[model samples]
Target: MREHEAQARTPRRDARSAATGQARRGDVSGLHYTPDKARRSANLAAFVQKTRAVDSRGAADLQKLFAEGDFIERIGALVAPHGLRIDNVADAYTMWWITAWHAARGENDDPSPATLTAVRAQAAHAITATGEIARASDAQKQELAEALWVQSALIDVAMEQAKRDPSRLRAVGDAVRQGAKGMGLNLDTIDLTSKGFVPVGVGQNDAPATTPKPGSAAPYGALALAAGGIGVGGFLMLRQRRG
Candidate 1:
């Protein structure tokens, strides 16, 4: 059977589709299923029936996720055999939904209390799912770790306070420094506040590095070239006259 059909019968995930009014459990077919899978399928149907429902974009991403088998299959091929349980997969889906909701709201630094609570819950679930996947192969583990980092960043943005405290700013700076380090770029020696801002390894009085304006060049070089050309032409004319 096809992957989507398999997913519709998979258990926890198909619940979102039904909940979003896309399809009913009875409508899903073309999957060879065991009785246990069938029972979970029905549960998914029911849970989806009463949930808040996902938006259209969320619905589409969920479909893509199902088509890709939640990335676990891809990760499995690169690494040794390991599996993602249904719950962790659902957590990933929930994380996506939360991220979509935040984005739709313009990703404000602070949301309403109720929204904040919901977002925090989603972030926590994502972190938990990442932890569960950490035991998988190195490739799989890295993917999970990146997902956790994304959620953590979202949480930080969502929870920023307006006090504009130095400590919070310092924390953000530290994170930026560390991220640069991860990319093998050391930025510690770059001073942003030095007087005159002479760049390291460059002469203090060196002309500011500006691109040559569209039609400009060093005058002396152009003059020298013109002089040389004239001298050559004059020399040739004299030689011709003499000849």
Candidate 2:
């Protein structure tokens, strides 16, 4: 992604309350990634690099998808901020989900077209199951989390297997579905189309801010201050001379 592209959306905060609140929600309903964002998420990039077939076609396709696909773009947005950091469990979960999502959806070695459809179906089911699990017992939540991670892992394995042989799409799909059962959450209602910053703090609102870029100088203020200082200094110098 171009630096200007990243610079375009000045790093404004949605009040600490909002950004952090989203962080705390532990839900993935409101996460969206635009085409531009996917290009910058290092974690996603790394995953692509490690698993994608090393060729111009694969490279170009991945790049293009990252820049244009809604799903890929959302993954990019999430990956960019944390860059593989598991600091927040929500972020970690989001990253893993997207990684799995992308791996399954891609035409790469992982999921054959038929299997890919099945994988999508499984994801839909997993998503639904996740919502149910949310209201279930603690044991259920733990079980759900594990199931989600496993399903996600199967996506990775499938992708790897595809890259290695390219004929195991069915196997990959089956593996992905089976693994998903181990993850405790579902993917259906966890909306991935809408994304915004969430903030949190005492009495703090989660409204996004409109501010100048960090490195951008407040030229007007600086000039005004300088002018005032210069005027004061000149007056002091003149008075001293007169004395």
Candidate 3:
């Protein structure tokens, strides 16, 4: 995709919570590539999702929708800090669900238009069925964590599929100092459209609604969807890339 839609409101956390989060930053091992390494301690905050109600059972059902794909490890690296507790089956299930949400591949290394639609549909369903799937302080954190997953996962897809490679992942990573630029915003403040950050999106001009673009939504539906959700003014642009 030429641009990944991304946008976020400023943080709503209190200074004390912010400070505590800062103190805990160094303990996060999820920043690496291991899924089981990001745990710190058992946190009890409930996920108050806005879309719908959910529970461990509902989350397990959602997991069945996930697709198997490559570079899921890359996606885990992005959201590891927020933490996932295997003791909490729903949280762990969601971690896997979100990971597969981004890493699944399709025919010729790209998904068909129908596949893209299905991806977007399932993401929407996830929002509905995952009110309590994650173990986070609140919905904002959930959004931040998931948004980061989208970022990392898209980079995985874009590495080989983006036709223009304008925001070359390698160069862009260097520009952000390996995501430090965005992370400096305290997760909530990381502006995807910030200086030097190119938002990724799906589709191309003159393309059919369901026509697949190389690395656009056809290949990176989760990425495209996340960009639109977090993107400026909450608009998902729907822009596409060339073949």
Candidate 4:
């Protein structure tokens, strides 16, 4: 999966609805904010934009950044001119997703564990390098945790869907919803690029979640890579957990 392709598959909020949509989630966008809050929000957006630009350019060096243990200083420095500061958990949370997708979309990788490792590494750095995670609201904290759980779940379901139809990623949101269904999570809409998510229910089936143990790093949106080493056998192995 190329970076642009991975991005193309990830759902982003419709730009026309960003303000109203993000505002409802109590995110950086609201009717008004303190001057400092507005500044920070702008900086965060700049950081996200700058980093994503690197991926868009088709540069391979992104894997180097993804391999680093701490993003607080590493990524922060890269996007500093663009105004990124590691002062808030929202920034930290957003960076994790960015790096995860970058890493997952890189070459010769398995998507599920790659996403998990990227997220875990970012959380580890956020915990050690800043007080923001500790200071984050309980709701924010839970959102971060659930997002992590959904990381592996997303890949597993996509892989399963790919078995029946390799182009399942073309409809990424729908595929992700099927993954959420197994966990009994009802989603109105789930967008990976968006900062917030709300699962509407546990599940219609009332089935217990059978999360896969994070095994090894991989790529996202690379159903084609399944043929590299994870072919039919690997997909079958995933059934127990993703079912």
Instruction: Identify the candidate with maximal lDDT.
Output: 4
In the range 97-151, model 4's lDDT, one tens digit per residue, is 4333322332112324344343433434434344444445444443333233224
Task: Report the poorest 10 consecutive residues by lDDT, candidate 2.
Answer: 214-223
The runs of at least 3 residues in candidate 3 whose Cα sits more than 4 Å from the true structure, single-residue gaps closed, are 1-136, 162-169, 175-179, 185-243
Candidate lDDT (C-alpha), each: 0.31, 0.34, 0.29, 0.35
TM-score of each: 0.19, 0.28, 0.23, 0.26
* C-alpha RMSD values across all candidates: 29.4, 26.8, 20.3, 20.3
- The superposed Cα distance between candidate 1 and the true structure at residue 98, in angstroms, equals 19
User: Residue-wise lDDT of candidate 2 within 6-80, one digit each (tens)?
Assistant: 665555443555777775454333111122232325433443343344343434433443344333323234334
Question: Candidate 3, residues 195-241: lDDT per residue as tens digits?
Answer: 21111342322111111111111122323323222232121122222
* Lowest-sum lDDT 10-residue window in model 1: 214-223
- Model 4 residue pairs with clashes: 109-218, 109-219, 110-218, 110-219, 111-218, 111-219, 184-202, 184-203, 186-200
Q: Give the C-alpha miss distance for residue 241 in model 4, angstroms.
A: 7.0
Winner by TM-score between candidate 4 and candidate 3: 4
Tell me, by TM-score, which candidate is best: 2
- Model 1: lDDT equals 0.31
Descending-lDDT candidate ranking: 4, 2, 1, 3
The TM-score measured for candidate 3 stands at 0.23
Clashing pairs for model 1 are 19-48
